[model samples]
Target: MEIVVAADASEKGLGAAIMHRFPNGRDKAITHASRAHTSAEKKYSQIEKEALSLIFAVKKFHRMIHGRKFTLLTDHQPLSIFGCKKGVPVHSANRLQRWAIILFTYDLPMQYRSSTNFGCADALSRLIANRQPPTEDAVIASVDAEVRRLFIDALRSLPLTAEKI
Candidate 1:
């Protein structure tokens, strides 16, 4: 079986497309989308968008994919090879580490494709719709109470003075 996934994000919204190609040349396609979050509205990085799109595709098709090896295709070069390591690296960004952890379950070898050739996923990605907000709380979830306290302390020390500089 062959699989192709493409994702696109815009200030207006975010979207992803997943495809399963049968050996006979027929194709089954899946499309996923979500509106931008209030928080993510300000922090929607392309790398993050690519990762999220791929994750949605995998989870949506988990029943067909689980415990079996299959092709993984993407337009983003880095995500196709992301977390190639056996485990999430200590130095990885909070979000990336989390995405990697989820992706680790599949035996996927990433392949690169150009943006133009992404097919339906490209068009699907451009569509806007009403959906749940994107949750990207990996950084907050990973922080321990002690770390939070230290961060608070560091912020407090920076400036108690609230005057307009």
Candidate 2:
């Protein structure tokens, strides 16, 4: 399997996308958006939130693929270091180290992309970041439900053989 992943981050929050190629030539996609980091904006500390968010997105992809080879794309360049030995520079808090460890468990190829080109992932991230719990609850709920339905459909459609049983 070949996969393309993308992530976007801003003052509001983080968003990620994963596109995969199956044996049948069809593609699979997964996206996630979550709250931004609100902690102090110290030198390296600012990346802590982004790193954690990236880890979350990667893990979500792993759950979907079950150890398939995948490529990761991100608007945040720091994440491209997962393939590096020394690892990327991060805060003294060791956030990068923690993220790198988790990343090693998967077969990931990293790449960088501009936010403008990230499309769906960028939109989802911004939507989640700007969401207002009171007014946007219904809209968010609808989108989440739709995504879940799509995921289930995709899983059910996966090629599985009963003869192996």
Candidate 3:
């Protein structure tokens, strides 16, 4: 029972994707997403964002991983230090110290993986909100489910564009 986790965060939000791998190499995935607090969005340092993403992941899935020693993969190089013989970053914010303590509670071995290699988790963390135009605009999308279905059906009837083809 080996659990591999990757987490990433953006100003708009944070997300983590989890994959559980069995002895035979079979695996399954779980994804977590959440909105960022306005404060974290405006002022969280780079390191905090990285640490927080992992924290969010671990806490969100603690039930599945609490008693086990799991591998934590992250794109931020500094985070890997927490798992090394060295030491956690002491110069950064005190919040980092608190986070490190929380992480230490679990026997987590952190590894630094490039975002490319951690695609699933990386993608989970970088969600952008879909903002509709203001109400005053000419195109207020229909609230009626039937109308929306009809509109989608109409689009499906059109020929595919070159790119789509």
TM-score of each: 0.61, 0.60, 0.68
- In the range 1-165, model 2's lDDT, one tens digit per residue, is 577665655556666777776889654674554554444522334456556656767766667645776666666675667755566566545667877888777777776767666676666556663434545788899999999999989977878756655
| Cα error of candidate 1 at position 137, Å | 24
- List, residue by residue over 1-165, the lDDT tens digit for candidate 3: 688877887666677877887888755675555545355354888778888888888898898789888888888897876666456666767888888878888887887878777666667666646553346433445456668899989988889865887
**Model 1 residue 14 CA deviation in Å:** 3.7
**Deviation of model 2 at 81, angstroms:** 1.9
Against the reference, the lDDT scores of all candidates come to: 0.65, 0.65, 0.74
- Distance from true location, Cα of 30 in model 1, Å: 6.0
* lDDT over C-alpha atoms for residue 117 of model 1: 70
How well does candidate 3 score on lDDT at residue 138? 39
Tens-digit lDDT track for model 1 on 97-164?
88788888887766677877765555565565556543557545666666989998998788565784
The positional error of residue 101 in candidate 2, measured at the CA in angstroms, is 0.7
By summed lDDT, which 10 consecutive residues of candidate 1 come out lowest?
Answer: 33-42
Error (Å) of candidate 1 at residue 86 is 5.7
- Provide the lDDT at 71 for model 3: 85
